[model samples]
Target chain A: MAQKTIAGVNLEVTEDGYLENPSLWTEEIAKEIAKEEGIELTEKHFEVIKFIRENAEAGLTIRKVGKSGIVDIKGFYDLFPGGPLKISTKIAGIKKPASCV
Target chain B: MKKILILGAGTGGTIMANKLRKSLDREEWDITIVDKHKTHYYQPGFLFIPFGIYNKQDVIKPKANFIPAGVNLIYSDIDKVVAEENKVLLEGGKVLNYDFLIVATGTRVDPDETPGLKGELWHKEIFDFYTVEGALALQEYFETWKGGKLVMSIAELPFKCPVAPLEFVFLADEYFTKVGIRDKVDITYVTPLPGAFTKPKATKMLGALLEEKNIKVIPDFYLESVDNKEKKIKSYDGLEIPFDVLTIVPVNKGDDMVERSGMGDDLNFIPTDKHTLRSEKYENIFVLGDASNIPTSKAGSVVHFAAEVLFDNLLCAIKGRELRAKFDGHANCYIETGFGKGSLIDFNYETEPLPGTYPLPGIGPFGLLQNTKMNHYGKVIFRWIYWHMLLKGKELPVENHMSMAGKKKS
Candidate 1:
């Protein structure tokens, strides 16, 4: 496995980019996360993003923000329960942290 | 010149800290918060972690992110709260003095409370996802594992999110299929409750969905112990369930500091008035979130609604006025059924989940009770709001009070 790093979010490629089966949950992915366009991830960054994703899936959208592009962010949500944290990590492109196993 | 000291910066503590920060004047009052860790978890995401839906980064962020600046954020474990003296002693022996107190130290998962649950297979064949390590480890374990009897159990109630185990089973069914092993894995969701959920209406809807997905639901089964050698879960009533991969939502109790300080009840939760969010005995003290003995789901919605009431009530307290703000036990939950859609339910102590459009009457881009892609979209979009809005103590477009504009009495 080749260990790769990006802005503190690490990715360990057992193969090429992403695994064909992804039967792999690596340490790097758990540490830092990958983020999407215009949003970058640092070790200190992901706290709030995961909060919204999980709470939204739980059926309570506690929105008090500007309405413009509010619906546009529908693509930003990961509704598959924990998908927000996973996607935030994915979009952040960071790997797992050291404290965890 | 009164000082308010809050112990533990979890959902209850964070919201209360923010509420008090806005309610009291900087000149007349001082508020200080204490906790050992730095990251704040969107705990509900733990259920999704094992299913590979939420990664570790999804559920976590620096604890400092949520605490509004200017309010003192003490990064240390509380040695004990001297309730009689109105002072908090930290692990480092630093002392925090308070004229008023709010005990929001949240719950802890006790795997040791369950016999053999924390033994040999703790993170191997058996795991608990209440924490980051447990959830991530299980997610990794699920990756290479073949399925047999995937038994998910909830040892007791007053757990953080009451609906999480059910959500886990539902998502697992969906996950196995997406991984091309749905037929190979047999999942049995084991619950301590007589119903699949707290409310009857939501239970009926949720239970039926469980059955519709070909997953079995065993209700009212008391968990006495787990037999690691036999790979079976033995209930107090003598029912035995076999499993290959076991996920346990361990016994959740309040932070030990609460018990050590003589501030909490038997389960370590602070005793407080259910509606007003006021500590029953102490006039200056208040409690909120999972830390309080409020009869509601410990999910984030309770905190959100409580924040609305509590922010006002705290102001009333500082002015030496009666706490008029009342929490109606309002809790709303989004139930994800997977496959690009989900169901939305909004209700409180008096209301059950009814079919209606939410935040808007019949016009929502999101639907309630019934599953919709729009509802799914609503669930997905909330992540942005959480980061940019909620923790900042800003007002959301949705009313602080649960709205009847979109919800029906039922």
Candidate 2:
């Protein structure tokens, strides 16, 4: 774990740059993280992010987000570009999805 | 008499029946186990079938053989569990009431979930080794395959026996090499995950091994559909890879009975308390094995370990005590790297697989995260252990919870 400053607040983060404490999340923090990933946070992005933050504990998956009624999987891929689940969870101020390794 | 109903007499439910029967008084309790199928498959051996290392007979036995005498075994299709009514409706209108319910209805591979996957070429050019039929079909196909673009693709995430796909390619490489068609076969592994595996360290190790075997890996390719006309698989993002023969781990979902009961997630896997193995919505209903939406590999090793935790917790619940045992999401897997060599990994919820020894520190007969002949033997001998020790709920040397004794933090 390493400490990094995001949105003028020092926070602990994992090696993958996921927030160590999701409770420290704010709308401003999400914007800063999105900017780091070279993505512009739009209202549609925020809708997916909000859904991700709320359901983070239930285990986040691209399939789950696709079925979230807010967006389809293709639209989600359009939102987060490279790896939708990985990027969206980072912007949502949550840990990366832990599938069985 | 009070009843304890266990559904799906596979590895998990069978073990639970044996364990609970020994602990609970037979005079006071009536234990019944039910499943539609009569044969209990040693699923781990299904991986060996395609390679001709084992056959259908080696992997299967009568479900009644492992079932204990005191427990009632019913071979009937399950209709649904009326959770609120504390009763289960069986096919042909039989009702079985339960004081407590244990759900162990494991997952099934649904090739139909993918478009054109079960199309005209199914079981001919395309196959899945997850089922007995699929394994046998693939074995027959491999017998005379001239070998070209043998693509092993995973259709979805969180499928049972996560290591099986990796093992399949490894074995395919060896089988082709031995049969003198190694150069002709263009082997590729396609998965939705970013790498060969989910965890960092294990991915690095396995990825290196795949490269060493001259296997090409196409990562981040989520299967959208299979194109029968073009003989290719298309990803959601419009990437397509042509294949001569496609060995797929199709979309795995929990039994339809779970959906009929109205007690499952989108995948039909019951929402379960990860630690306690109890159903999140129904207090009296507990979930075990692949049927539960737990963040762990859906493997027999997981069911074997989780059974111990569930046994303790269920005993506590029966005594009106707090559920004490917590399942650490422990899963042990032996990765068959082919050529009679294999690798082993031991991991839990919070810990990733570390390289070291297993079951013993500094003096392990089995190496962890390291490929060795001993690990291969461990996997081979596991068949005996599965049939004799594991399913019978006999105590093994390994503990239920994961131990970090021999593991080294990187």
Candidates 1 onward: DockQ, in order: 0.01, 0.65
In candidate 1, stretches whose alpha carbon ends up further than 4 angstroms from where it belongs are A1-101, B408-410
lDDT of 2 by residue, B208-311 (tens): 99999999999999888999999999987888999999999999999999999999888889999999999999888999999999999999999999999999
Top TM-score prediction, candidate number: 2
Write one digit per residue (lDDT tens) for candidate 1, span B226-309: 898999987654678999989998877888888888877656777778788888877877786778867777777788788777
Chain A: TM-score in each model = 0.25, 0.96
Pick by DockQ: which candidate is best? 2
Model 2 TM-score, 2 decimals: 0.98
Q: How accurate is candidate 2 locally (lDDT)?
A: 0.93
* Candidate 2 pairs with clashing backbones: none
Each candidate's fnat, listed in order, reads: 0.00, 0.53
